[model samples]
Target: MRRPTIKDVAADCGVSKATVSLVLRDSPQVGQVTKQRVRESMARLGYVYNRRAADMRSQRSQTLGLVVTHLRNPYFAELTMAIEDAATKSGYTLFQGFSRDEVPQQRRLLETMAEHRIDGLILLPAHDSRPEDLLETVGAGQLAHVLITRSVRGYECDYVGADNVRSGVLLGEHLGALEVSTVAFLGGAEGSSARRDRIEGLGSGLRRSGVTSPLALSLPAIGDEGGIPLVDRMLERIPCPDAIVAYNDMYAFGIMNGLRARGIVPGRDVAVASFDDVPDAAFQQPPLTSAAGHPEIVGAQATRLLLDRFEDPDRVPSTVLIEPELIPRSSTTSWSGRA
Candidate 1:
């Protein structure tokens, strides 16, 4: 049998096809009585609305696209969940893509989402590439876009991220408070905004306490297995570092493993601290002292910003920076009953 259509429902209800469309969309413009009548007619005629077609006609997909660099990273995973929850609550659905920290992949994903007519995009850029080109494409396609966790260098866009600099400063101060003279920073790619800001903040914070400059070492991207070799190199240095600050909990874990292989216990022999308080940070041999970025808060804020852009395309882009907190654990303690 032929599927019942909006025309059939309209005919049965003695109303225009437009009325059925409005009723299906739950538009407030349609009177409650009329909506009930249309629904009854739809039920009687077994009518099913074509949501995609309706969305196309209305020029609003009511869907949001999310692009993240690494799906395996706990921070990104938590952020994804928070964004999904907020999107669903706001009567929108999410489509996610993982870019694997590659710029080309990120660009391709943005193009694909734009082609699919998503209402808006929430992107965690792979690096400091100007997103204006992508944003212009989305705008030309009548879609809205926002940046989350990572921001474009020159272009202003709705962005939600933690104050990474502040977090770094806090970490440095914590280490300085312990009077650890020599410290090393490990992990993160070169030219990464998070890396640059964090290192600067950490150095400045340490300087505030009259501590000398801390040595920094870059580790390979997350899960790249380069941390093993990097740790080996650090160990070979004359007079190894007294303390280490990792880019994130994952890197800290790798560092800890490397320390163990060298017969050096993390907390007792050399103190360690990092960022992103992932669940594992708390369960490590000696719980990790780290800076916590509330991914859930960032995700929700990003969703709201994107939704606002979708609602008002002409609104100016805004930047929202959430502060980070420190989670002190056993990782930074010394045998002398000091942290």
Candidate 2:
């Protein structure tokens, strides 16, 4: 069977190929009557408009690319969903890829998006990716790229994320109000802006409440695996911390599992608090107390920012910092603090 071509639609609509092309592209220049006629002809002839071919001819792809460090992480999942929703509303489709925290994979995905001529990209860079070329290529190609959940220093680009430092500070204050002396900090990885800001904020909050030189710990970047070992080591210490502040809810969950294995009940033996109030946090045995990172707002705002750049390439880069809110649940109910 022969495939129907644009010329067939043109002939059936009694219009030129150019008119049919414009109508297929949904160009506003085509009158409503003409667009309706061309569409009706296409439907009648079973002629499908080739978007890829049209994009190749026009040198403009209408697709958006989204790359994240870990899709398994609920926070990233929420963000991706929001971005997809906004892209659909704006007549654009999204192509998503995950790096699994691998820098090489991230670079490969970036190249793929570029090769496909994706209109824009939203990236949550890998924890170890510090390449200057990454930003250079984005700037040189004039691609609209927005950083979500993470930001690179000295890069002039649009970014949307929570105030990690403030979140940490709030957590520290909460612990201090509970008079939780000898607190410990378990974090994602060193050299990550998110980790640095969170630790700094937590330290400041603890200091302001008269806790000096609180024992801070940095776990290996092996996600959940690192959390168990770190907690085991902490248990061996003579004077264990009465309260544990984790980098995120995943780490907190790991800690809870480790404690359970040691016959220690979390929220009772030792209070635990973490950030990023992912859905699973609420369903945990004792329900994790955490800082709400608002992934949906971050995702929606980042998508909007990138689209704005697409509309006006000359627009100035912007930064959006969302405030984190503390959710107190059973995890810290036993502690001496306001419920």
| TM-score for each candidate, following the candidate numbering | 0.79, 0.80
- What is candidate 2's local distance difference test score? 0.81
Tens-digit lDDT string for candidate 2 (1-339)? 898887688788897565676677687767899889999998999997776886664775768999998776788899899999877755568999998877788888988898898989999987777757475556677778998888888777889999999999988888777777677777587768898888889888888887876655545455535567768777675445678888889888888887788887788878899999999999998999999999999988888787767545687889999999999888876753334
After superposition on all C-alphas, the RMSD of every candidate to the true structure, in Å, is 9.6, 9.7
Model 1: residues >4 Å from true position, as ranges? Answer: 1-57, 131-142, 216-226, 335-339
- Compose the digit string of candidate 1's lDDT tens values, residues 73-93: 798899999999988766678
Clashing pairs in 1: none
Task: Indicate the TM-score of model 2.
Answer: 0.80
Error of 1 at 51 (Å): 20
Question: Which 10-residue window of candidate 1 scores lowest in summed lDDT?
Answer: 216-225
Model 2: CA > 4 A from native:
1-59, 131-133, 222-224, 236-238, 336-339
Supply the global lDDT for candidate 1: 0.79
